[model samples]
Target: MTNSPKPRARGADKRRRLMAAAAQVLHRQGVERTTIADIAQAADVPVGNVYYYFKTKDELVQAALAEHAGGLAEFTGELDKLPDPLDRLKAMVGAWVGQRETAARYGCPTGSLAVELDKRDDGGLDLEVGKVIRLLLDWVERQFRELGLPDPDDLAITFVGAYQGMSLLANALRDPEIMTREGNRLTRWLDDLPSAREDGG
Candidate 1:
């Protein structure tokens, strides 16, 4: 008889499920509106079991922030595979465009969360949100640096800020096509940059 697949590690699997579910629920419902029981139900794990992994809702939200940071790392890593720096930047724009529908439905995942968390006097979680934004900014800066742009940092900020502003507009207007149009404009901006090293060596 064919051998059956091995059973997954229950403890680790539950924690992973809890973290993923926390991210999803927190994205759908803001942190102020979400609770441990909500995440437990979304994760399909017992409410008591959630405490075994995270002692409180704040801890669970922290886990979700870490999960988002991890996702950002993976995202930049994929962009690293492309040979052209401009292409990588353009691809990033394309990714935002692809998520237009989701953005319109619930706003940019990290952006909305950060805005909500920023209103609080609490310290740690706000820093975690900064880390996520930093990851994207730093990655974009590196691409501009490689392209020999004189103001890589400023360019990176502009690039990412434009996307963030567009995301806000898309959500505010409930229009997904705004992202598509802005993405195309951003791609054109990238393509119009000087092909030669701007620093003149």
Candidate 2:
């Protein structure tokens, strides 16, 4: 009799399923409402299977946060295509606000988790959110550096802070128009900066 092909390791498959399900749950319901049982049901796995990979709900939440952060990193790659520093800054703000609007309709998995984690003190979830936010800030700084601006880090923080604040305001008010107006105003302000004007006419 021919030997049957060896089956894939069930442990690896189960972990993958759990992560995927966690991502879906966090995206749809936000981290506050996504329980272990909910994740198990979504993944079609036993509740015990979740604990096998993550000891606590917070651990699972961190994993989901990391996955969402990875997605944002991919989106940031688009900013590298622009040649102008001011233009790059504009693109970054536009992309961020546009993403917030998209998420508002379907739910912002990353932003939701960020807000949830912010309310808590020192913890794994907070650390994960901090890493994601730092990554975004670093990307902004790099864009400023590429544009030949001095103190890229500070400039990036200023620009990102403005955009983030505006995003929060727009989201809270359930208005995309506010973001659009603020984004345009930000772009105009950036264009008027000394560094931008020094680059060319």
Candidate 3:
């Protein structure tokens, strides 16, 4: 019985490694261009081992989606710990701007992935890729609502749109500084908000 547990534990470890590999490969090569072989090589597992865990590439994609979702939740969870709603919102913005270098290279993992998946028209998989953006939108909306904004949803949409646009520009220009500048501009705009002033009081 103890020996049986060893195999299960190893299987779980392998699966975790495979999931991490999938996310890395997907980000570097994109979903359409990435092959199971790439993922296996990244994970340092034999190519045949990929089939042992995942029956199809779509299944592996789902695994990667789960990883992204977990990352989104963890990010928001850290922000949720902050007492001030505006501070939480700023922190969220800062995170993207802080990773301006990475965005320049990879172009916002969730946004780029969504665009690629949507271009393929892979049935409902686009929705899966969209969940990350939706999570961000929902979090931003919640922060605005906590600040008692009348149009919290609209504010959320505006902020997310600007962030994504800045990311696109940063990636296209190969300049992280552009993203940082845009983030600072967003901070100034947030500060000048009438609702924010009222909420601060």
Candidate 4:
């Protein structure tokens, strides 16, 4: 099948724009409030073209969720560069706090999406949301494992749970400083965790 020259050149670009726009709109506006038209306008694409790419709004939402999942995977990989696993864990927490203003204004992107999707009771969307959450949990757990923590899984849960709880409060209070303070506290806590070998090795 011969793809039209113009469509061929821009197909990838348009889809990329649409997916990026979908994630932005979904994060800022919530999935229920976000519409395909909203994403099209954000992407500056013709409304009809959205249908060509995504059969329905739900499909677009899934794509947007996938984009987030991909980002988390990439982020975790980058954090691996730090020599110390504990440092890696702190860096991850610092990143969340680094986006203080943005998170305060819009809330945690993946966290908010999970809440919106959960409220809708849509079929199987919870799995998509869970995947995003799991990505962070798993990465943090890996770092804990490296530190030789006896209960890396439970320790990972503590780190992520504190992060998300801080995110929620920061959003509610619209105070980026709250996250910064909590993030600093987390870094200190990580520093204080017994050496993995010392703890249980």
Candidate 5:
């Protein structure tokens, strides 16, 4: 008897589906309420299959956090396309505000994960969140360096802290307009920096 053709590996596809499902669950139900069962159901996979990929709920949470970080990294790439560092900074801020607005409409997967991950004193989850934050901070610092700033690290930290604080406030108040305004103000401040001014001139 002839052997039938073997199915494709499909492992990558299955992993992507699981991550997408986890993001949906986190966005809709909040990270604390999201369960393995919910992710399995959302992905249309058996519980055993989910367990095969993730040994524990925390592992799955970390995977979801990685996915969120991946998305932010992609946003950084888009900002890098701009020639001017000040423009790049503004684009980055605008992209973040736009993402927050979109997430508010459906719910924020990253914000939900951040809330839970931040509370834990020790875990891989916190590390995953740190990775995401660090990536964004690094991107911001790169822009500052390109602008010839004297203190890229400090300025990047300040920029990221202000952005995150404004985002949390906007999300809490359910006010995208506030986020937009504050983000623009911050961007303008960066643009007016001496280094940026000389670069632009």
Candidate 6:
């Protein structure tokens, strides 16, 4: 007599499914353009059932934001297993380059969402949207700091900005090579940066 999965476990799985589908749909279609019914369809959950997990579209959007944040944390944790700061940072850029086609099509999962949310007349949602970008920026800043950079924060902002800026152009131009080219340039730049200790900072 095997025990069946608990109701709580089933509920959690359904909630996670909703959030994952919401993230993909939101990334492909800006927040304003996406609806709870669309997410319900994508998740394969009944439209009425969606409200049991997410009462409003905004709630679902928040869940998607949390999903992105969790994914970023997990990805950075994997990179942290690499010993050298430079290696980790370069690997980060490599991953981005690997996703050039997707970025060219979707304009970056985090960056596109951030841009769209930031422009919203509803001020509340925009405030929460920065969490995704801040996570990446803070992670990059930590890597730079570990490399003994004198201005890790500034370097982190510039590094992340370069990726976001190029992602925009790549999507607008429908050119994946834009990301490949800029990612390579950023990789080379990362390799060439001098450590603060070397400069006696």
Best-fitting candidate, scored by TM-score = 6
Estimate candidate 6's alpha-carbon lDDT, on a 0 to 1 scale: 0.90
lDDT of 5 by residue, 46-140 (tens): 88888878888787777777777778788777777778878888887777777667544443456556777788777667667777778888888
Provide the TM-score for each candidate, comma-separated: 0.92, 0.75, 0.91, 0.93, 0.83, 0.95
Candidate 6 residue lDDT tens string, 9-90? 9889889999999999999888989999999999989999998988899999899989999999999999999999899999
| lDDT tens per residue, model 2, 79-134 | 66767656777887677667666544443455556777778776667778778878
TM-score (C-alpha) between model 5 and the true structure: 0.83
lDDT of 3 by residue, 101-185 (tens): 9888878777888888887745777888788789889989998888887789999999999999999999889989999899999
How close to the true structure is residue 199 of candidate 5, measured as C-alpha lDDT? 62
Candidate 2 positional error at 108, Å: 5.6
Model 1: per-residue lDDT, tens digit, 20-46? 999989988989999999999998999
Query: Which pairs clash (backbone N, Cα, C closer than 3 Å) in model 2?
Result: none
For candidate 6, give the lDDT of residue 135: 89
- Model 3: runs farther than 4 Å from truth? 1-5, 196-201
What is the model-wide C-alpha lDDT for candidate 2?
A: 0.74
Weakest ten-residue segment in model 5 by summed lDDT:
102-111
Candidate 4 clashing pairs?
Answer: none
Off by over 4 Å in 1: 1-8, 198-201
**TM-score, cand. 1 vs. native:** 0.92
Candidate 6: how many backbone clashes? 0
Rank candidates, TM-score, best first.
Answer: 6, 4, 1, 3, 5, 2
Lowest summed lDDT window (length 10), candidate 3? 192-201
Error of 3 at 33 (Å): 2.0
